[model samples]
Target: MSMLPSARLLIVDDEEDMLRLLKRSLTADLNCEIEAVPDAVSALTLLESSRFDVALADVRMPGMDGMEFLERTKTAHPELTVVMMTAYGSIDLAVQAIKQGAYDFITKPFEHDKLVHLLGKAFERTRLIHENLLLQKRVREQESFQEMVGTSPKIRKIFETIKIISNTDVTVLITGESGTGKDLAARAIHRLSQRDQGPFVAVNCPNLPENILESELFGYKKGAFTHAAQDRRGLFREAEGGTIYLDEIGDISPTLQTKLLRVLQDKEIRPLGQTKSVKVDVRIIASTNRDLAAKIQDQTFREDLFYRLNVLSLQMPSLRERPEDIPLLIQHFLEKYSKEFGKPLKRASDEVIQIFLSHPWRGNVRELENLVSRAVLMSPGEVIREEDLDWPIRETEECLVPAEVSFLPYKEAKAQVLEKFNREYVSRVLMRNNNNVTKAAKECGLERQALQQVMRRYAIRNKELLSNEDAE
Candidate 1:
């Protein structure tokens, strides 16, 4: 029941005296701005000129009565709240006005207090509408950059971090598993940077051989190689004054690593079969699914190159880490593919949602997008069902039988049920993770030591779960 002091109200009636009384009383009681007009025509003219929160009109007015005014007002400004005023005999007309789109009706000679209460509720509705519109505007602004959608604290923190670092011209190393949106994050940084007007070039490192990748990164001079028919500018040169995202940087060969290190140290690249180095101005943003630290220890990747790339590191969280965002992501993809495919699909079924929440998203966001896209395209009904989804349900997910059941005591039955659940759940988690205890422990929301204790209780040995090659 909060009153808006700034709420604007419009009152229309042919009776000057009635309009005067209403304008005076309502203005004082509601503490809101009031505009009174003699006829419905004048009121419509005033409405066309100014915005109003609520309108009070007489149902018996001549030459365009309140009912017509209500209809026209609703058609023009659907958000506007209107209440009809009528004489005692015209209560029927007021009821018809309600059917046409009147907020509510008040008879003539009504108590001023009743009108004030009704108008207060109407004003609150207007306020709520305004607030909801503002909220939706903000959500659209937040999601305008890319498909990186999430309200979880981790994702919000990443958003904040990206904004803070966007203005700075520093190397950013985004490390995460494949399909974790590392490329999207790189594009977001480039879009927000001052050099946003320039081109953003992406290079998939593992996609090409070392010799070709080197020539592609640092363009070769004409006649530099077999395809020397034309002079070409490499990806770095193409991204001048912008950003060049080197994806899967960990997979590049040692020779390429050394060349990349030199470029990082001095902002210059020596193109393949070229005698001189060329200076280039481009921001470097690299991402990798491989563990660069492990590669460094194994002497496969250069430590100096790793140090240069790891200047400002951003580790993307896997989809399973932020399960709260799964529903939002699903809805986003559903709407996207639905519109693209011209389908009338609305949402996924509850069973489908449950399956998504429980399943391990190893392929992360990309896997979810592919699954949702396929589901939306293939679903026969508007609602996406479990059967419509192509995701395989694990055999471990089958019903856990209380084998030691059949009229057993309540305590004994409960113990057996708990034991069965623990064993099956642990086995399922381990199987999914390739018998990797650390990963299984994390999926189970337990520390390695705690999971080991549970495993001992169930006599579950990890070695037995491993494949023959892995065990050997």
Candidate 2:
């Protein structure tokens, strides 16, 4: 027997004769086990007692109707496949059933082959859905940390880094562009660390003034300052035997950096206007988008504090660097928002997905998630089509097909097009720099040799190309 034929089935109908007819129709062709129930209540009872591969129910039953029965069945046993059989089939009902999680529907007096074909597909989809759920559950349970979903090598490297640093108590410095989920990474480390149960206190250092920031971090005695009305415990005290995440650490003043360095070095905190220092054991996780090395060179950031926080550093890749992860991320966001909004969004259209992959997500995962949420709310139905998505045309244009093209032979045309682009790009860079290769290389994110190679290939060697006006 085929896999579909071997699947367990449960048939539900108000009439005993109809139940019998379904049993006979399926049992004759299927090489599997079958159960027949007279009403929705009995069908539900059977479902609770024993698992079935598929459930087929009549729409107009005596008690609970097919729609209600399907909803209850799906809620109770989401892994089971459900197909509704209705004499009165309309577009509204079909769409409603599908939205309520029905696998498929069959009309009354259905042909034998059509019934079999629909059932086969239902079983297959059910099997796949169940398998994916099992795998996802296994990953969640075994990994202990949330699955950082991406197959890109850059993301893989980040995973490796997380795994390596998770077991240690070293201060982790996560440097990434804003909205890159630095906070999530910090939590993942805590989850994988020995201090998993301890409190994780996050403080954004840049959002507060110097006095308030210090007071919030170190706490204050009653009347310590104008607004210090009572004795207060600081974040360092609250984070005892736990972790304290200092976000935007680079934005803190040099004076505060000195005070912070003392906390790292001595593992003690002195509350504002307090005479004594309180000893506290805490792991520090700091994140920033600024280049701390440059800040240190400029004397804006203290070198001593920089070294303390740099013990373990992780650089998060920009969204553009890992375009391959866009599809997975999009699906993740879609499912999340669909569930949140209580809507049944099946899938994003291929064109919409392609647009997402092609766009430069400067704001990273956060931006992508917002875009998906917006689209889900605006989408009229289950499917999210291309028109449902809103993309910035300028950002997409860089990665999408160019607007203008010249006709040429297949191979030669392509070469000529590439040459023209290279020449134009090189000329622009040279004009911007007045023909200075070093400055142009920095602007283009290319090495001097690489820029020269492009120049040579395009056959553009005008010394004037290096002149300031030409570069501009």
Candidate 3:
């Protein structure tokens, strides 16, 4: 007989004897990867890191019972095949469990062969689900960026610009408020451009230190600086014959601004400490969430370079301005993140969708994606519900601090609530700035390093905050 492949399983029960019995039976009957947890809390912690094909949970236990556990698992991890174990064998309980999305029920002292049969059926079901998800992904790959999931006139117009200008090597400038999908627009342009086959290099301008940005942009020869141990090619060299996306163009200091202007004008670059300038043939696509015209008035950004980069301009509409796209985006993320997290979630409830529609998506498409990612990870039932979503609470401006600040102590319940807003606000700023702490700091009126500290404190993953310059 052909042996079955190893399948991961989570056995949740308070009875150590029962847990041991289940492990022994499953291991003996089939090749399995098993983790026996005492309760739902432990099971959830394990689920956070591991993907199990099936979770066999007891119906009754202290703290979170099996029924409750089943509800939570189905919500957050709909892809997981769940089976309930109960000693009482009550029909009402079994019916309730089935309603809550339990695969089936196994009464206490069940036959060993029956346990193996149930697992075999669950494994086959999981295999089919995985195969279907993979097929859907392949179908989506041809035209999905997770950014092009809208049908609004504003977004359609942006696509028109991409199609018209992508074939040329003209310097295209994309402008939008922070959270608008500028990065997506840039990538879309490149994907459809003649240079699609070329490398799509993305550089968040302000992320690199000003002192080193020059070398990062332009190649540096050996001995260019104290620690220039070897010759190094710059981003331009890396993007040669392709397109280099210069993000947060407004954040680049005036010094490097001049060098960048020369690169655009002369189509050549001089390596630091090298006499000869190398001729480079590359297309430039630059994006900025900042207002270059206003910066030009303030003299923080170069006017000549602004005109050079704006040879072909595309402006992305913000999420609030295009409410019609919200549903499409939510639906897209429901499928996108479902496949991404290995959890096939059901469509969001109307209440949840309404919340998404009514709320001002200040963070834009990227924010919506984050919200969905969180909801998918935390929802307890097969479908995402309102409580699973963490809505940003409204803060009062009357008190420079939270209105409850005086009544609360540091790290208290209300104080932690305040931190939540700060976390989200800082996250939006960073996403808007393309994770460039310098630019985000300048915009948020905090120091570059200070903004970074805030990100670290809230565990706001800079990389996880995805934004598309004007796509927000």
Candidate 4:
């Protein structure tokens, strides 16, 4: 355990001998600076002029007893750690002092080493509290500018885009894989925009049925549908003079797409139940993981609508593409989850961190956040370790082609050979590593995502490996 060399300690007691004794012990045993005071008045005066980490008070001081001193010190400086000293006859008073915010108490005839140990524990607690505060402050700072949580070149470019376009009224299209923080990017845009003061509405197009989704976006009259109990305003109206984020915009049906295109062009929306078109003054921001250009070619998505939505586009890079930022993201999630779960975990161990950096985060930041949250909740230690995580595993190279592959067509036979190789290779490797993806991936000479994709293609399950391991 490391000591805080700069920590200042106050020894307050009426007996000059007790004060001197404590000062001698702490100064000899601890790295902190110590001062001895004869009475509560001197301690209070010193506290006002200088900062002290911990205060050791004797219970029977004149004018102000240790109990009163502890209470006053707590009220004035709640962060300070206070320990009371009492005789054996007044053990009840020591317990009372503990109830009144005293960190701990020592008996009057305590050993010098025991007191030193107590002071060490107090200093350690103080250190942890300050470290937590500093970490929280850094978390806030890291996410303060537009609340984007990455420092990669790609993310920096997106930040620049947000800064330049936030002041404008241009529509933006954010595209990324699922869990790549598309919604967060949209919020950042809204937060930095001129209509930040207005309501920022969001609609998930795929979550609702076609007819219901329409009414949700464009409100229905009381009798428009079975569930429409009363007249309601649509998202466009709710987002008046603000931004409306349309998540999974590519998932909407052709009919809804046409209506959306009309709304985009005419700046008006006709509600399901209402006959009149409602003109809306709302900015549009859409996000999707689908390939809209390919959809247009496939005739599933409208070309004109695609052009309109793509006026200003920002594609969020996948987590694996920016491996250098993994450490920053991990620390951010560690702090976030620590606070949320009330465990307040510190950084991961070196081995755990190496695994984190090398792991192919298939689910991207979302996966990382979920893993950290789980670790913080379940980890017995204050720091995260490899055992605290559930990592994926890759296949080995022990796969062999079926005997019948030799009789198949040349091209078909080669495909069969590779498939058999991958399935067997991956499955064996997973079994060998007990289904740990990062370690298996490293052993198999493949990225975590590559191994995962192969496992997915073969419909391999980690449970299979775990069961085999159990059998072994």
Candidate 5:
């Protein structure tokens, strides 16, 4: 374990001698900086000027009671750990203080060992809370930039494409299956672009009709339409000097496509029922889950517009193609939902992770996120078990291949089970080692080429399990 810095402590008591004794006892065992105060007011003043890792206050004070002091301190510094000290300890008071967010309380005449143990636990809790805050901040920052969480080669390629396209003003076409994070890629481009400080407006082409979409894209004048209450700005004008993300762009009608192409060509937009065109400076980032090329060939989509919007392109890989990233994604989601639900779920079982790896996530990361969130909420303990998740795992068809035998004897059954276990173990080891044949062989105590032969015989090619480019 990594060594953490010493905790700063504040001790408050009405009795000066008791305060000195408490401080001496604590400082003798702890390497932390300790401050002793005679009253709650002094402690509050000190807290205002400086930060402390933990605060200890006596329950009975002349001016302000320990419970009130603890409550006020918590209000000021929610992250600070506060413990109450009481000579007349009551179970009711302890329960009430805990409910009010006190870290823990100690009865008066406490043992030296008990004090040390409690303070140690409090210090560790403070350290963990600090670390969790830092990690959460980092996660939030990355999420704001729309960065995907994966180190696989396939994901790295996607990241590279985003990096290259973000510096340019060219139109981008993001193509992928549904729920494959097309909008996330668009946001990443916007965040990295020169207009990063400008507004990022997203409009779904499939959600609105052609007439409504035209007016929505280019603001209409007041009274232009029956429901037009007043003049309103469209998405393009709202995103002036920024970027406009059009999701599901393939669903746009052919007539609308022509008008869109005109806007791209002219760099201007004319609102509905308006004669004059409005000049706009906005970058276009369009995404679709369909094959626009096939649509253009079928005459449903225009080739000119396709060419216009296809200045740059990015493709998102499916979860099934990058199974190695599943564990990281699971960890990410677990942390997210555990904090969200106020439950600290530690880890998923190996069986649960194996099920995740084997299943083809048709809905991609979105599906995995939802499943993990539900599991975290439903789980009764710190660890998330396979039974806590509702993920579909078919035993007979999805995982197991049939054995060639009409009736299996005990010996045959035993052999089949052992063979299956060996194959599964070998496959897991190879995957965990990123398909490094030599490393996996050494780990499994087998010859390098012998492991390779077993993998081949089991139909578990390295390329099939992990992408060839990633394995390299």
Candidate 6:
């Protein structure tokens, strides 16, 4: 009989006869691939080396008893389904095994049909779990925009705009708060553009001094400066026939701006300490978090250069403006860091997710990514709880009404405070109850209709909370 490809089983028992019987019975009856191990240690080694749909381990083993093995297995591979077997099974022992995350507990003297039935259920659970994971992956793919992940209308519009702009050779200016992935947007443009085969050189304008920044943008001769040991190909030359991304462009000095404007206009660059200007062909993409318009008025930024860079512009929305994308972003980061750190995938607990949804992500997407990366390393279990997060304590201590809010009219100030409180309160209750409105309403001591009205008033979305299965 052909075994089901996806349903692979591992049977761990100390007795050689038991192992043979299990391997033969499971393979024939369930039509599943079976690997029988003589001991729990061998089973764990197999688990570390390969994937299995379910693991059946005996509670009574020679060394590293079944209970201890189960604990270690769950710690390392929390997604693996496990079922405990014991000849001396008691109600207390069964409950203990269940508490330790066993999919099921079976007495060793059980009939063949009963064992098959229990394993069948365990395999089904594994199948469903795998299917759910694939579904989540498909959902994330649908919601993503190149390297950026978001399903919100604002982000979707940004994706559309980027696609439209990628077809053109005109200069583009990307404006957004710091850490909002302006660099990613620039790269996306270059990747989709005609110069996809050419180099993409990125320069952080604010990180270098004025003299250094100029030379870095345009190549310099061997004797250009004291430290110039040899002829250098600057970022412009390095990015020939491609795109040169100037990050934090508003921070560049006026002298640099004048030089940059010349390059944009002339389509050439004069190397440092060189009399002749070298002809170049490259696209310019600039990004800034600062207010270039205000700087132009203050004479710090050149208005002419602004016009050159702003031929096409994109404004990336902040994390706060697109709060609906937070969950998807969290999922994205969790998947990223878990694989990088070699840790079993972990999902944020309902409480932790509530905190994430409420916190003002001042650092934007980068900040959230850092937080998730740390959580992946710190969390010991399958779920990332409040303790795993960096700022849950600070989140709990935040003021409902800001000091600036007190300056408003008394009625308005009070209304704002009440609105904020209701939003936070209702959202937390819904998250705890997996967004079941009736259950959350009961927990909040409000009628279902009244709670629904409050949700409508505050624009709270039922879709914001993680479902129980999703959280796991």
lDDT (Cα atoms) of all candidates against the true structure? 0.84, 0.81, 0.81, 0.82, 0.82, 0.85
**After superposing candidate 2, which stretches have Cα over 4 Å from the reference?**
1-75, 81-132, 135-147, 381-391, 396-472
Q: On residues 302-361, what C-alpha lDDT tens digit does candidate 6 reach at each position?
A: 999999899999999999999999998999899899999999888998898888899887
TM-scores of all models?
A: 0.64, 0.63, 0.60, 0.63, 0.62, 0.62
Q: Is candidate 1 or candidate 6 better by lDDT?
A: 6
Which residue pairs in model 1 clash with each other?
none
lDDT digits (tens) for residues 45-143 of candidate 2 = 998889799888877788798889998998999889899887854646866898899888888878988998888777787678777988998754543
Worst 10 residues of 3 by lDDT: 463-472
Per-candidate clash tally:
0, 10, 20, 8, 0, 0
Summarize candidate 5's per-residue lDDT along 84-163 as a digit string, tens digits.
88775475787688889998898878888988888878877888989999998886554333557887789878888899
Better of 1 and 3 by TM-score: 1
Task: Mark the 10 consecutive residues where model 5 has the least summed lDDT.
Answer: 392-401
- In the range 217-302, model 3's lDDT, one tens digit per residue, is 89798998999999999999999879999988888888899999999999999999999999987899999878789889999998
Off-target runs (Cα >4 Å) in candidate 1 are 1-52, 55-79, 84-101, 106-118, 132-147, 151-168, 191-199, 207-216, 220-232, 270-276, 297-300, 331-345, 393-472
Off by over 4 Å in 5: 1-37, 41-49, 53-147, 223-226, 342-346, 395-472
lDDT of model number 1: 0.84
The deviation in Å at residue 437 for candidate 5 is 46
lDDT of 4 by residue, 1-472 (tens): 4676588899888888877777776786787899898999889999999988888889988998888889889999988989888988999999999999999999979987888889889998887878888998887665435555777787777778887878888889999876678898899889988899988999988667898888888887898878788998988899999999999898789999999999999999988778899899999999988888888889999999999998888898888888877788878778888888777567888887788777766567776777777778888888888887754422123437567887999999998787777876676566445577755664464556787788778778767654643553
Ranked by TM-score, the better of candidates 2 and 6 is: 2
TM-score of 5: 0.62
lDDT of 1 by residue, 335-378 (tens): 89999999885699899898888877876887788788888988
Error of 3 at 304 (Å): 0.7
Q: Report residue 105 deviation for candidate 1 (angstroms).
A: 3.6
* Most TM-score-accurate candidate: 1
Better of 3 and 4 by TM-score: 4
How far out, in Å, is residue 2 in model 5? Answer: 16
Question: Which candidate comes out best when scored by lDDT?
Answer: 6
State candidate 6's TM-score. Answer: 0.62
